[model samples]
Target: MLKLDDANIEAICGQAAQLPSPSLPEVAVIGRSNVGKSSLLNAVLGKRGLLRVSQEPGRTREVIFIRVGTRGYVVDLPGYGFARVPLSVKHAWGRLVEAYLARRARGVMLLLLDIRREEPSPGDMQMVDWFRHYERRFSVVLTKADQIPRGRWKSASDGIARALGLDKDNPPFIVSVKSKEGIDSIRRLLTQGLMAE
Candidate 1:
């Protein structure tokens, strides 16, 4: 089991050039703006108020790299879609994210989706396509699971997976920051990635 108690922010990069050199495996968290990426991360790392959570979307304008234990990192990519920022700024974010992803062949991505949303947005589809195009390792994680009834989880996850062109039987990870559900599973996944040699 990989320990996350020692995890700490390692770097905040606004551009690809500033990204830390790849030394260990990374688990990259990604999602649309206001999808609860920060909250999920905080829960997984067992640290409250570690990653700044903002009511306003698009507050995370840069890629944040966090060192986890002595073996790996957890990367926070800027959220896409539904941000109130200018078009130019969004474009810049897209470019920077693209650059970072293009270079991280060894990294695994956790693509988050709001559990309440019935359909995957255009931005979500684009991200899925990008990951497939590059043959990168990625997993879908449904956030805010506590907002919906527990009985609806199965159906909701299946619906989202179908929308994203993924297997319904193997639905995405259903998570809730409030309930701390599925946080340990995500942590285990990241731990496995880090432990792999």
Candidate 2:
């Protein structure tokens, strides 16, 4: 797998059903609001400010599709946890996201989690369970790893691993957008060449 020809990337749509016909492979980025999902995505695409980053949580209110290179897309899904919206809005968001997750045949999910948090939220755990039940392809990414001291990165990752029942030695991809640590590995995974593999 090689890096994407990111220069050709373009947004498909802000809504799921409105996505351009599945002309390419699709990868979805999902996590709690403010988990730095957008930041991580920018790093992966080598495009700062391409996707909207907001100080406000839940600012991303739609399913955004970005065509990457010539064969695939990087999907930016609206954040789930702690969006601070009304219950009705949240439920609506759930329905919207569910449609995409359950129906997108070429979709893979990149589940992001905050590394500094004590444990995965109940909602996050439930999503994992759902993925297992449906046999969905997904990957975990621990975001904001730079917040903790470099010496304690492993301990922090291991703690999260233990809490989430992940392999302590093979914890989720831990990364820090601020420091650009662990971004290359993710970029490789996201690159068009690797997606073909």
Candidate 3:
């Protein structure tokens, strides 16, 4: 199993040129603004306050690369949609993220969705489309699973999968940082996937 206890920041890139060279396998975490990406990272890595969590959206304006010992990296990409930032800044972020995704085609992508949201946002659908277009390895992760009743999880998962044009039988991972639900599974999945790469 891959260990994440030794994870450390490797680089913070504002532009594509500054992104670290693809020296190791990587898993990129992506979601809309304030969708609990930072919280999920902290929980999965077994570290608190490692990645800054902000009440305000769009605080993560750059690509953050974190190296996990000698194994690989867990990349934190800027969140898309529902940020209060200016239009120009949002566009810049989009371009930077596009550049990073295009360059790191070999990396795995974990696209998070808020479990409470009944439908996938436009931004979420766009990401799914992009991943499919590039034939990239990606998975959907539903955050804040604790907010909803456990009994409804299956139906919710199936609904979101259908909305995203994914196979309903293969539901997305449902996680909650507070309850520690599915965190270990995600960690193990990332470990196995990155190791195979």
Report the C-alpha lDDT of model 3 over 1-197, residue by residue, as the tens digit: 77788988879999878977677888889999999998899899988987999989987888998888888888888999974678998788878888877775456899999999999999999898888776778889999999999999988898899899886555699999989999999998788757855
Task: Tell me the spans in candidate 3 whose CA falls farther than 4 Å from its real position.
Answer: none
Predicted candidate 1 versus true structure: per-residue lDDT over 1-197, tens digit per residue? 77887889989999878987788888999999999988888888988988999989987888999898888888888999974678988788878888877885476899999999999999999999888877777889999988999999999888888888886454599899898899889988888777756
Worst 10 residues of 3 by lDDT: 98-107
Off by over 4 Å in 1: 168-170
For each candidate, the alpha-carbon lDDT, in order, equals: 0.87, 0.74, 0.86
Better of 2 and 3 by lDDT: 3
Clashing pairs in 1: none
Name the lDDT value of residue 137 in candidate 2: 72
In model 2, residue pairs whose N, Cα or C atoms come closer than 3 Å (at least 3 residues apart or on different chains), thus clashing, are: 1-193, 1-194
> How does model 2 score by TM-score?
0.86
Lowest lDDT 10-residue stretch of candidate 2? 7-16
Ranking by TM-score: 3, 1, 2
